[model samples]
Target: MEPLDKEQQLERLYATPPVYEWELIVNPMHFRTKFACLLSLTFTFIGVGIFILLPSLKGLMIASSPIIVGSLMYPWSRYLLNADKRHYYAINKYGMYSTSEQIIPEIAYTIVRRSAWVGCAICVFAAIFIGPIAFVGAGGAALMSFTMTNFRSVPHKSQCLFDGYAKLRNYRENEYSLYTEYYHYGFDLMIPESKLMSIIGVIKQYNDTFEEEFVDLYKDSKFQARPIILEIVR
Candidate 1:
């Protein structure tokens, strides 16, 4: 008789339905944006120093400082707080993908919206503090600040393979809520970090010897569907 394997053991336990089948793809735009935001925020602090501590810019400081700070810091803080949760998957015969940008555009929009309000509020504050010079200085700073803060990812040649607008979906199970992004690649996968059992389950389902339909899913196995799992050492 053949040796009983781990996959065989799992098949006997935790019976899963076909319709709930999922292929997970990890897209790390959030992690990358978090790093970028942190860097941008640091630069914003430097700009603040130049505005406040530098004696030469004292006359223009109030207006410029808020503008510069708002422009840079606002976007940085916004993206940091609201960066999207993106995932990629292929469902049935269709390719579907989603990203945080698609799922929570309001979160991103709110950041910019608040920054715009800050610019306007500073303009009023400047008028109260000084006069025309203050207003001009404050307004100019605010405009620049707004410009820097609200910058977004534009579709251009330089974007990475994972960078682009993708589809978004929301999942609600009992009390848990999850946001997912699906990227439609003709045939590309973004591997995600998940629980060891979850990963094994996907592999077992796909590699099930009882089913030959799994092989038909991908035409090419070379770069297409290479097994990512090995024996779990326990």
Candidate 2:
């Protein structure tokens, strides 16, 4: 059993899953749904700061803040809140994949949707108890949540993976998002900090000895998919 285990581990390490099936574990209830109350408070502070710092742009800031928060924050926040669900995806070396044919997201989406009502109630409560200042702020945040698009990852039956290797992009809440002068077909993803150190190790290995399909893009000169740190800008 030990020998077999070692053999399997080696196989997984070397074998590329070009046309294999992998289940992406996704939480239906994502953390962003929980940001409603917090964002409401933040807007209040920003509003106060703007009013204090530059009174002239109060109207402009007030009008634009919601639009900004709604457009960027709202959609990103949608990714934050989700129910517990698993999405099945198939990826190929050529950058193609397929998802379940279901047109709608998992039932967990409804649960997260309803949770927004609770989020609304929290905002209303915060507005009342926290004072009129907070009330205004909460209203703005709630409005953004409402008017802003709640983007969801709609499952498709099948699709081609955009051709590109996974590039290293480290996103921290504190840092601004970085730009890439060169663009590739693959999407940029945020990896867990814990896994980051290990990723660097893999890249180093590829530099030392070009192997591992996962590391192929990073070393290849044609695409030059070298790692570039990316952060999500708030």
Where does candidate 2 have its weakest 10-residue lDDT segment?
173-182
lDDT of 1 by residue, 1-234 (tens): 885464553343223322223333222242454556665566555556545654454455553655355455545554543343333232221112222222246566566667666766666566666566564335555565456456454321111111222222111110111112322322233333344235334433433221111114334444331323221211
Would you estimate the TM-scores of all the predictions?
A: 0.36, 0.30
Q: Evaluate model 2: give its TM-score.
A: 0.30
Clashes of each: 10, 13
lDDT of 1: 0.39
Model 1 is weakest, by summed lDDT over 10 consecutive residues, at 170-179
Q: Please provide, for model 2 over 1-234, each residue's C-alpha lDDT reduced to its tens digit, 9 standing for 90 to 100.
A: 454453454344335564434343433333445465466445545656645654554334343343334344443444443223344543334332334322245454464455455455555554555445443434666664453234344554433232122333433321111112232333333333444455345434333222222323234355321222232121
